[model samples]
Target: MPRLFLLAAVLAATTAIAAPDNPPVPLPKPPQADRTPAAGPPVPAEKPKEKQAPAAPEPEKEKETAAPAEPPPPPPPPVETEDRAAFEACTAELKSLGAAFRTLPRIDDGNGCGIDKPVAMTRLSAEVAIEPEVTARCETLLQLAHMTRDLIEPAARLGLPDMGRLKAVHQASGYVCRKRNGAETGKISEHARGNAVDISALEFEKGPVPMKIAASEAPDLAAAFQRTLNAAACLYFTTVLSPGSDDAHRDHMHLDVMKRTGGYRYCR
Candidate 1:
């Protein structure tokens, strides 16, 4: 105990001598850490709460997207007009062939039926009269003229030799604006476009005779004439429907200038 008292007095004397001007200050204790984490369940170590920098504020009112432009409209359909050069040329040719025709107003029954330039055919020639007249395009009459002048007249002289010269041709249909075979619905007929003619009967110096009777009874002469007419019509027209071709054409001959692809001619 005496030794400890003496050591203490010596430490005080040394401290006093070392710091005579200033007294020694006591140091403060540091705070202890609570290493024991949250109570309840053990939480995953909160990664040292990362010190994050503040972010820029977002816009309040949203911007709208732009709209796309509209597409262009389609073009109009082609107009149905007569070709001045073609019409004039056809008329000139028809006049030379002894045809009596007058240019008529346009015939447009809409619904896919129209004739740009049509003609009223009074007669093909003096002898080959168009009984009751007919309305057709120039091309049709031209084809008829070619068939009658070259084929019909010659065939009549030889086949119908007993009946005398053919006086006139009785037409049944031309430019009537009806469907094929006169159906309620189907492909538009060639006659609707002024491209066809239906011959119902033929006239001789003797008198008029229905084609049906002439075709069967006069099988030797008159029937030969009908056959010749049908066969020869195919040469001039792209389509020719005769008595035996189908039920629709059994009574009258249907001839048309309807152009087919590859210059194909339909003879039936």
Candidate 2:
């Protein structure tokens, strides 16, 4: 009877401790995934500032600046009426002399004469009357002629020695009114437009340079003529070649406006 009582107590204890067969409550449904993104503790709005030492001052910012403006370009110079009139008159005169010359606009040498500063006669209309191919060059030659005459005639006014002393001043070899080299080739020479003149020898009252015995031996007369020609050449022509230059130049003095370029002068 005591053993029976012990077994009944044991059975009661086991029944009281045994788990139920029903499933768990399901955790109260969580809060639905659509209603809440996560299951975490709520975050504070503003973080609490911690007490600390004082901070150093920051440097000031520099102000931005604007760039400077560029200067304006200058204006063109006024044309000279006097120069235009003079050129017109000269052109008319040349037309009467059988020259087929024409007047054209002058191109600036790009020296900034108008842009940098103003000046009278800023441009020139060169006289060109050569063949069609070299017409422009021929007009330049005509202008060279005028320039040459301007130089030589002044010397005569200054009481310089007359060329009459030379053997063939006007008659030794007449002006060909032709090109540079021989007369056969159509290729134009510097002389075609009166830019150059040839003098095989000079004539004087005494006789031609060849006929005069002492004159041929003396260098003064020849030297004087050469000096005069060269001086005039410097004023009018960009290039000047004489008998002394080379064998090709042994016959005549060749002069041309081969230089006055880009406002640079080359006279020799």
Candidate 3:
């Protein structure tokens, strides 16, 4: 009986230990719409390329569309003046006069006076007071004065009364025997060739007034005279000096064709 009880106890203990050792496993389930598979790491998808078309050629645009190229800038117009024809004619005549005197050999008056002796030409005539010592082309000198008158007359007609009434012109001194100055002698002055004229101002009804005297006493008349004479000189003379200059010249208006295209003008 003791042996039977021991065997039964041993079997009971083994069964109890085995029962707690492992639980029963459940059966596999069928796939369902809502069920998901076991997941792994995610991977990236590749991008697709687009098809390309051929490039087209471009045509040139017309010049009209390109800012018109600025029209190449029109040339400047020529200068116009009222006395263009007469002025040009006088200039040509004056040129001829110059050619005649350019070749005359310079002759020195042998009196230790360093002055050139001028040759007198019989061609020009004069009406102004002439210094006996100086000689000049008479015809050319007269022509210059006449041309000056023509220029002044037209301007005078414009009702600039102060320029004087285009009165008779009187050339006081032209060709003179003196040197350019009383001191050291040099080339003969324009007076030597009668290429220059000293106008004793203008002849107003008040008599021939000197430039210096008029500037202080009659400013309007003086200004008009100076302006008109200067304008006339531009057409006739290359050089024009007036009493308005310094003490070197305070007596008369001196006019000469020494320059070519430009000369000094005065208004006093």
TM-score of 3: 0.41
Q: Residue by residue across 1-268, what tens digits does model 2's lDDT show?
A: 9999999999999977885787558666666757957657877779779888788677776777777776654433332123555555655655544454443443232211111111111112232122121222333434544643454334333423543322123212212333345544344444433334333443344444421112224456545545566556656656666555655655555556543557453433
Clashing pairs in 2: 127-139, 128-139, 166-203, 166-204, 167-202, 167-203, 167-204, 168-202, 168-203, 180-189
Q: How do the residues 137-212 of candidate 1 rate in per-residue lDDT, one tens digit apiece? A: 8889888888888998888889877777878888999888777888986577887788898888888887776666
Q: Compute each candidate's TM-score over C-alphas.
A: 0.67, 0.33, 0.41
The residue ranges of model 2 lying beyond 4 angstroms of the native Cα positions read 1-90, 93-149, 153-222, 263-268
Report how far residue 224 has shifted in candidate 2, in Å: 2.7
Candidate 1 segments exceeding 4 Å error? 1-80, 213-219
Q: Per-model C-alpha lDDT, please?
A: 0.81, 0.43, 0.50
Rank by TM-score (best first): 1, 3, 2
